[model samples]
Target: MKRILPQPLMSLCLWLGWLLLAQSLAPGDLLLGAVLALALPLWTVRFWTEPARIRRPHLLLPYLAVLLWDITLANLIVARLILGPVRCLRPAFIRVPLDLDSDLAIVVLAHTLSLTPGTVSIHLSPDRRVLLIHALDVEDQADLVARIKQRYEQPLKEIFAC
Candidate 1:
């Protein structure tokens, strides 16, 4: 079973995605989706170095809820900033220390930060110990660093802890 569907969830998503893209539930599409779902994971499995394993999987829902809420709030704040005076803008780049040992978790954290309103994940240090983030506006750099650590990094550490 494992060999047949190396990533079962990915397979299911591929099937659903194929159907959605095709915009039809015809028998041929179903067959093609099933084949692609089975084949893609098998072909690409070799490229994956390590499989992801969530430490406290139960916290995933709460984490997602918090992320969604933050994203929404960020959108509003960014919109306001954009519409307001340009002179008040205080854009800066800050380095955020990484506690996540897993590459996958670190990548997810970076992506999440990028998805939020005024912040963008600039780069990760070569040692992978720190992530560089650029913020569009900031009154206090320390506060921004602290919030990123507390709100996003800490949760990711817990979620991806080994």
Candidate 2:
């Protein structure tokens, strides 16, 4: 069973995604979707270096809601900053210490920072202890670091339990 269905969730997603993409539920489409769903997972399972597992899966929804809210607010703030005087912008790179240990958790944090409006993840320390992020306008580095840890890292630590 493990060999036949290496990643059942992925297969199911692929199946559903195929149906939605094709916008059809006809017999032939269903058959094709099923075949692709089954085959794709089997063919690509070897490339998955790490198994996708969320330690605190129940926290995912709330975490996502918070992230989305932050993203929206960040967008508005960035727009306001961009419209203001160019000289007022203070771009700086700040190093955020990592608390989450898992590679997946680290990846999520980096992606989250990059997704936000005024910040971009520039580099992660080779030791995986710190992430360097570039911010468009930062008044205080310490405060920004504190906020990132509080708003993003804390939730990710809970969500992935890493």
Candidate 3:
């Protein structure tokens, strides 16, 4: 029943993850993995009262490709700014408003933004509405905000927001 069992996918992942991690299969290990897998999802259920529903799986490939490219570009830009002859950096704050409402999706977006070099997700407003991102260099606020909204938020919205 839903009362005891949690997300089925989580349980399956728990089982496989433990198997791969432990590298040996014993009865005790199997039982422990199963128990942990089930328990974790049950505990995490509160975090997502409603399950995440990704609408377009195909879009993920292109999204990931772009993110990877951005990572490389960002790393280069940051390195140049730091190690070059002079730091002709343009640092500034940009507020990115969210169209994706789900907590999981928003957290992923925040983390992804933070992970990219030269940029950091500084804060998300208490209402979980707008994200404050610190860019190591910036040419224009409008372009940056528009880029974030268009490049990341739009695809994420299509994928996770329906």
Candidate 4:
């Protein structure tokens, strides 16, 4: 069963999604959806890496709250910066050194930075030791790097244990 259905949940979701999009219960549609659901997961399973193990699952809620709060605050700050004089904008690209060794943790950090307004993650070093970010207004690059490390990276390191 495992060999035949490597990701049964994914397959089920795909089938349901297909039906939902098609909005049909026809036999042909059902057959097609089933075929797609099974085939897609089978084809993609080889590309899937090992799943990330959360070391501190309880911290997830707190992490999410912090992320949401930061997003809200960043939205207001970015709005102000955008509305203000163009000359006041100090856009800069800074490389944040990573203490995270896990690929999952690094990806999460990159996504978190991108999700927050005014900041965009540009590139990750080949060795995965650093992440390059572009910020809309950078008063102090060191401060921003430290804030990210403290607020986001450190928590992620603790949570993911990487």
Pull out the clashing pairs in model 1: none
lDDT of 2 by residue, 39-145 (tens): 99899989887766677878888888989999999999998898866666899989999988888789989999999999999999999999999999999999999
- Provide the global lDDT of candidate 4 against the true structure: 0.92
TM-scores of the models, in the order given: 0.83, 0.79, 0.76, 0.75
Winning model by TM-score: 1
On a 0 to 100 scale, what is the lDDT of residue 45 in model 3? 87
**Candidate 1 colliding pairs, count:** 0
**Best-matching candidate per lDDT:** 4
In model 2, the runs with Cα more than 4 Å from the true position are 9-43
- What ranking of all candidate models by lDDT puts the best one first? 4, 2, 1, 3
Q: Indicate the worst ten consecutive residues by lDDT in candidate 4.
A: 45-54
Instruction: Please give the distance, in angstroms, between residue 4's alpha carbon in candidate 1 and its true position after superposition.
Output: 1.9
For model 4, residues 37-88, the per-residue Cα lDDT tens digits are 9999888878767545678979988999999999999999988777866666
Kindly report which residue stretches of model 4 are placed more than 4 angstroms away from their true locations once superposed. 1-43, 85-87
- For each of the candidates, the C-alpha root-mean-square deviation to the true structure, in angstroms, is 2.6, 3.0, 3.5, 4.5
